[model samples]
Target: MPLGSVRYERVIAASADDVWALIGRPERLHDWFPGITACSVEGNRREITLQSGLSLPEEITVLDDRLRRFQYRIDSPFFPYHRGTIDVIALSDTSCAVMYATDCDPRTMALVIGAAAAAGLDRLTEIFPTPIFPTPE
Candidate 1:
């Protein structure tokens, strides 16, 4: 079956290292990711509880510090295949771009996960507020 994919990017006024420090950790999803109420990670596996009380299992695929990329695959029985990737790209010393991408077999799952990903990016922006520049005299 062909997979459906979606990608969302947000430019945050924060260093890439700082951005990665928050979202890069698999065990910290509940702290920032919208809709996630709680998260428990053990070894390479993770279980997340949603605001709706639904729980889902996931597998941590990649956590590359140097590249600032975090990838995971949803291991829920309902979906045949689902993969999510979060990448932080450095735009400058004090700015970076966050990309959230999702791939799913059912196609519609992509839309669902994509929306949540969008909100998660928004939360990241809120957590790392844009820096204000001082006006020249």
Candidate 2:
């Protein structure tokens, strides 16, 4: 089946290293990702609890500190095929860009996840509030 993908990016006034420090930890999803009430990881598997009290199981497929990126796959009935990645790209010494991308089956699934992803990006700004001037590319 052809996969559907969605991506969202945000520029934060912080170094890439700082951004990575916060997001690199798989267990910290609750801190920046909206609606995630809790996150726990065991080996490569993770469980995330939503505000609605729904728990979702996910597998940590990739954790690349060198590239400041990590990818995970959701194992849930709602999305039969789901894989998501978070990447932090350095834009400047004092700023960086965060990218969240997801691929799933039934193309329309991307839209459902994209809304939460957008809110997650918004939550990131709350953590790093110094918004730099030059727009992100």
lDDT of predicted model 2: 0.88
lDDT tens digits, residues 37-70, model 2?
A: 9999999999999899989999999999999999
Stretches off by above 4 angstroms in model 2 are: 134-137
The 0-to-1 C-alpha lDDT of every candidate, in the order given, reads: 0.87, 0.88
RMSD of each: 4.6, 2.0
Q: Candidate 2 deviates by what RMSD?
A: 2.0
Among these predicted structures, which one has the highest lDDT?
Answer: 2
Residues 11-120, candidate 1, lDDT per residue (tens digit)? Answer: 88899999999888888998878888999999889999999999999999998999999999989778898899999999898988889999997888898889898888
How high is each candidate's TM-score? 0.91, 0.91
User: In candidate 2, how many clashes are counted?
Assistant: 0
**Model 2: per-residue Cα lDDT at residue 25:** 97
Candidate 2: clashing pairs of residues:
none
